[model samples]
Target chain A: MFYGYFNGTIAPTDQLAVGITDLGLLRGYGLFDYFLTYNGRPFQWDWYWARFQNSASRMHLKLPLGKDETYAIVMKLVERSNEAISKTGKATPTDVGIRFVLTGGYSADSISVEKPNLLILAEMIHPVPAIQYEQGIKVILDEYVREMAEVKSTDYKRVILMAEAIRAARASDILYQKGGEISELSRSNFFIVKGEKISTPDRHILHGITRKTVMQLAQSDFQVEERPVLLSELYDADEAFTTSSTKKILPITQIGELTIGDGHVGPKSKFLLERFDELVKTW
Target chain B: MFYGYFNGTIAPTDQLAVGITDLGLLRGYGLFDYFLTYNGRPFQWDWYWARFQNSASRMHLKLPLGKDETYAIVMKLVERSNEAISKTGKATPTDVGIRFVLTGGYSADSISVEKPNLLILAEMIHPVPAIQYEQGIKVILDEYVREMAEVKSTDYKRVILMAEAIRAARASDILYQKGGEISELSRSNFFIVKGEKISTPDRHILHGITRKTVMQLAQSDFQVEERPVLLSELYDADEAFTTSSTKKILPITQIGELTIGDGHVGPKSKFLLERFDELVKTW
Candidate 1:
């Protein structure tokens, strides 16, 4: 069951009462974040809303609610979604994902400083296959540039286009490259393993919720450094992987024709995968 | 009265439905286009849908409808939106805009080879303020390096964020620069005039619908060249203006702290504006 939030109610997904006139839909003028529910509760809820608020602030658009109040709105959506899913016998509380979208108000004859539109949605969670833990996945390299190296907006023309190449390469996903350096996958953070160390780009891409969790998860296993990753380093790495809110941890086995470190998922990837799922189950 | 197109008939915007697991919402995986409706009919409909088709094909996302069929869907949206407005006794047939959005479908486990989700939305059009064209408006500058410059995907974060600066800068819009050369504006195409020659960076930004219109409109009045527009040239131009589907032709009064070309609307900009509107009435 998908819950649509508009007019301060939990309506059916098809009954969404918004249109292109909503600034977010019109100009791609809104910001949103996706987070998963574990044990019927949302994880890292603060970071998700904070990013949305930060993005809205950057646009100078009027958010419908204040910080705490905004969180309250999302909580309302989560609750409504929980109730709807409960009515379904096939689903459980822990099997849901949530997305919160906040769009700047519709364009007026000139400009109106009115309140922005808010829509919070939820659905069943989709997790990548577990076999990727032992075998790793191949990734075709995306030879395009992301529209903005920074900021989060609704225009997904680049990322969605790259998802197919990921499947085509017989690879699990893609490593987004711009000017020969890797940026991100379709909607995930990328990491390269050098010996026992983990490195990633510093906030040049969307700061994924899972990527943050992985950094926290790695404190005990290896030191994680955030920096610009060079393309040359990808070829020499002992292991590589991409992280996102949905997939959690996806190991990259090959880049085009060349495979990384004997062309298989590395030992460190498995270790991180185990740690990731463990946190999901325990935390 | 916004008509949301699903599989078959025109439905209420609120009743419009998309699957919960659709890739469009999940991965931000989709391609879309917006067209300015002239009077009651969509202008340059072929160009608009062509770009959508091209973007979808490049990204390997399937379009739910072909060119002629998609065209019919948009026309349905326009007719319904105009009716909705006239019923309220607030809008005229001339006031309308069209948007077509197509997302990859909700297939389980994989997204590359799934059926697509499609929606067409239309609403009353809002023109720029009458004063904006006469006196022009100020603009801010920013940058974002995207992964895919050629394919149109839904990833729009950079300019959306920079729009905040535009608001604070007391400007109406934003233009982006790459490696010190002005690439394009957030929603409009950037241009700088030096005497009689008008120059702008091509292919770095969306070749805006109104932008192309102006290029044709300027054939007899001034030289329109597609090339890398330098920062120095922008700072020293005799006049500057931006073009888009929404704003039509807008002259720039200032960029950053520097006053543009006598710090007011220039003669050439006025000429182009008159020419553009002349074309719009018949466009």
Candidate 2:
């Protein structure tokens, strides 16, 4: 019972569509933010909404609904999804993921900016396997940075084109490097732990909500540095990991052929993941 | 009158839509090519199709239909557009512009590759105003290079976000510069004319079909050089112009604040425009 909200109406995901003239489809001019619900409630809703607003503002787009209305719609979809599970005789309903897309809208000239199209998609959440999280995942490095890296634009052609290579390498994701600096992962923010200090690139990366939460969780116990993390520093790091809405603080045990710090989940990464889990469980 | 073909069905442009799960709309994983008709027939159809094929290959997308079937679908939309114009009581039917879009199909995971969705959009050709070509157009410079510059991926967020600045500068398009080299315009290929020499940047840009046609048209009389065009060279050039499917050989008189060769359309640009007109008239 996956549902979606298109404009003002809520409907089944399969029935939602955008017109052909939409710039999101025609020119790929749009922004999107994804986050999963925790215990049937949107986790970090304010943070996600703020980031979505920032993305829209940077892209010069207008929001179709206020924060309250958007939350209402998400709740409606969540209720519908859980109701379907209840009808299935399931005792415990799982969480869901919500995505907000704001497009440049329908243009008659195909170039002009008109009223924007807004779409919200909700799907059943699928968690990463516990073994992968316990053992950590591997990532391949790519020498590229996303254009307009600060904005959460819906342009992922670079990583999408790297699908074959990623699969061939048996990697989970691509860690983007540009000009000797490691910026971020394809879909998340990256961090490295050296001794008692934690560092991540502050520029040329999306400021992930999960990343922020993890930083706060470790602020009292470890030093947090949010500057440009150089590619050279990856070799000296004792532990590394990525953070996103879905993969909350999954360790990265390997990159390319280099095994990160003995090729096993480091104690620092496990500590941060434990803190993240504790924080989210309360939410 | 406008019509479009989606998958195997042809309908009015307004009635066409793509599913919400499409990667083209969700992640902007797609490629597109646009060309206009010459005398009710596709101008440079073979060249356009070849380039489209290259773009798809570079982007790792599969064409949904073979060449013959694609051509058939395009003709179907063209005929539908013309038929609608005939009902409007117009005696002289105008040529139409066809845009072929191939998107990463509906991905269940929103990350994996799937069968592509093909959409063909046909609209009545809207040629650039006669005066703009006579007086030439102005373009602003942006310091960025598109990722996967060789592929015609549907990522135009940079230029789309530049809409207000472009309008404020009264510029029709953006000229991309990277590492002191002038690459191409946001939607066209650029060239500078110096005396009898014609030069255009051959890398980090979309290889425009019209740009190729103009080079061939001028080869018999003018010296053509395809190489890295330096940003410094724009000031010394006698004339400049941009070529694309819609704006075929339109003169460019001003870039940023600098005037090109006395700030008016130069003789060389006029000559090439005349040649292009002559070549397209026969088709």
Candidate 3:
């Protein structure tokens, strides 16, 4: 069972709704942030909150609640969701996903929204299967650019429109490139590791919280570089990976037809993944 | 008393709602089309429908209703709205605004939506005040680019985020520019009038229905050129204006500190506005 915090009230996910006139629905003017919970506690909560606040500021959306208030609401929703799931004769989920959404509230004019509506949703976490980690995933290069690339806004039109192509290619996700410069993936940040160096694009991409942590962890052991990653560079990289909230470090073995580092999960990627898992426990 | 046609049911606008998990609300994955009604009859319904179909196709959203079916539903809503206003002891509005929205429907996963929710809203047309036309309007140039520039998706983040800057500048709307090339305004298409010639950006912009009509009308009497309009070109143009469904042809007398066409409405703009009004009557 899913639980949701709508505005200021906690309720079942089914009861959470927004008016059709909400700018988030009518104009797609909204911001969202999602992070995972481990052992019923939010992982990297402060970093997620800072990113959430930045996204709201970039989109000019006034979040209805402060970070602490939002944290309380999320904790309550998670508790309620676990209770509801237990009532269904199921064990409580060890981990769950939390999504905070802020939308330009109901509008009669359909142009401007003043009072923003906030929704917090909690659901069972679906982890990437071990098989994907054992055998790294393949990705395809697509020529597309996201709008408001900095803010985590609700305009995923480019990716959604390319859903068919991504599925037909049998690729896990797309590596977006504009003018031959690689940006990021549809839902994750791209990284390339060459020998003792790690690099990722620092501009025209959503700066993921996990990406920051990965960079910090990588800097401790390797030379980390944050700069533009071109499509041509990925073909020659010794190893490649993606970072996201749910998928900490996913190895990318192939880009289109070219394989990276013998087309297997490299030692660097494996080491980083292991380190990420170990670090998550400390949080 | 506002009326709305939601999915297949005609109900009060207050009853219109969408689930929080709807992809349209979550991912801003939706498309919309709006046109005006004159004397209780939709103006250029065919053009609006064609554009609506094109937008939906570009966004990969399957509209639930066909042209004829949608027309029938819109006519009913308009009639009901007129009746509601009349029953309130107010004069029946001669003009009304009709909006048709197609949203990626409720999704449990919030990533993919196969079913779509349809909404048809009819409201009394809010005409631009006469003073805006008489005194003309001032606009400012903004450095922003819209994503999926051709598709009319529901993502207006750039405009909303810049709302404060626009108001502080005392400008009516924003004229978006990228790399010195003038694209369009926040909600309208930009056109520059050089004596005996009219030009507007033909690419990387939403192809407005009213803009097409204006081009057709201008072609009958003037040399119409549809090409890229640059910021430098606008500073030297004799006159400028914008076109949309509601605000037919609004003269732009100033762009920042540059006064367009002697800082007053040009004769050509006046003539075009008059011609547009006359053409509307025959519709």
Candidate 4:
């Protein structure tokens, strides 16, 4: 009973469909953003909206609706999703994960852009296992960089193709690097801590909202440096972690074959996750 | 009146709809191949099918139907397309461009793979004007390399985003390069002729079927080198051109600000195009 907003109508997500001639499908010319809700409320509405707009603008797509109108649509979908879930006999409504996909619309010529199609989807959130968050997760390193790194385009073929290799390596995700410089993960931002300082790559990577929040939270306790991080820095790093809408601050103890520090969850990431939880609880 | 085959059903292409949960639309996890029909028959069917299978294999997508079954489906769509086009009162039916799109099917979780969705489309062929072929088209050089360059995946966002710039520069397409070596164009394979020799990049390209045909045709008259072509060599080349399913053999007279050898179609490209036309006419 998950719900989604396609163009102008709200329908069952499973029934929502896009026409065959969409450039988004034929040419992969689209952008998307994902965010979470806290008690049925959008955790960081403004930041998500701004990033969505930035992605659209960077990709030369026109946003059909203004901020207020789009916000109204998201809220409506949120309400509908929770109501539908409650009907399943749950005593309490659960927080939902929201995703916004804006694509270069249906084109008579498959290569050209038409009116953009906007799909806002609401689905049940699946939290990462507590054990992974507590004990830390593993990541593999890949020698590649994403095209249009600043924009969240629907071009995840490399990551999708790496599924087998990731599983074979007993890794949960991949950290990308190009020309000896580490960039970011397939779907999240990477950070490494050394002594009391935190560092993350600033160039050729997505400017993640969660990464920004963690940096803001770390200002008082640790020194944060946003610059190009070298691949050589990972071998002896004291700690490492990744940030995303779903994985706020999942620790990374193992990278491919290298183990970070004592091969356990680090204190800085735990501290930042606690701070993030506190901030979101208030929201 | 255009028709398409989605999964197993044939319908008007405009009415063909893919589910919203498809990884093709959500994550761009798909591969595509397009070839033209000559006299209502697929030209070089074996080569095209082989390349499509290679792309699918590289992208980790499984084709739902085998070659014989898929050929039956394609022939059905082709017949339907011609029948519908003939209804428009034209005395003769037109040859159509056939495209095969294989996507990483619908997934409840947007990131995982499921049964692949196969879409076969038949559309009117739009040929480049003879004037452009005579005068030659201009292309701009881009300092980028495609991810999974050998696969025909649906990741054309960079090319789509460069549309405005291409128009501004009065260019027909983009030629991608990495680390000072020219690879290929946005939608075609690139080549340069020096004296009685022609060379095209052997790595980081889609290995276009048309490119193979042109190389084979030129073997009797010219030395064909399938190796990395340097960007520095482009400036002084005697002639340059591109090959694609639609364009076949279109000459290039300009590369960004440089006018290639007096800015007119070169004799080598003309000779090759004439050979290609003769070869196709016999089919």
All candidates: TM-score = 0.79, 0.97, 0.96, 0.96
Could you tell me the lDDT of residue B277 within candidate 1? 72
What are the chain B TM-scores of all models? 0.92, 0.97, 0.98, 0.98
lDDT of 3 by residue, B1-283 (tens): 7789887889888887788888889998888888998777899999999988998888778888888999998888888988888899998886689988888888776777679888899876778888888878998888887777777778787777778887898988899999999899988999999878899998789998899999998988999999988888876799899999888999999898888978888888889999999988877
Instruction: Order candidates by lDDT, high to low.
Output: 4, 2, 3, 1
Angstrom error of the Cα, residue A130, model 3: value is 2.7
Q: What is the Cα-based lDDT of residue B146 in candidate 4?
A: 85
Residue-level lDDT tens digits of model 2 in A1-283: 7789998888888899899888998899988999998877899999999999999998889998999999999999888877776787876465889999999999888888889999998886667889888899999999998878889999888788899999999998999998889999999999999999999899989989999999889999999999999878878899999998889999999999888888899999988888888877878
Residue A250 lDDT, candidate 3, scale 0-100 = 96
Q: RMSD of each candidate?
A: 4.4, 1.6, 1.8, 1.8
Ranking, TM-score, top scorer first: 2, 3, 4, 1
Pick the winner on DockQ between candidates 2 and 3.
2
The residue-by-residue lDDT of candidate 1 on B49-146, one tens digit each, is 77788888876776767888877777777777767767988754654676677767665643443687777766556678889888889877665544
Worst 10 residues of 4 chain A by lDDT: A85-94
lDDT of each: 0.71, 0.90, 0.87, 0.90
Model 1 lDDT tens row, A171-208 = 66666777877778766788889887999987458877
> Model 3: per-residue lDDT, tens digit, A190-262?
9999989999998889999999999998888999999988888876799999999888999999898889988
Model 2 has fnat of 0.77
Error of 1 at B245 (Å): 4.0
Tell how far residue A242 is off in model 2, in angstroms: 1.2
lDDT comparison, 3 vs 4, better candidate:
4
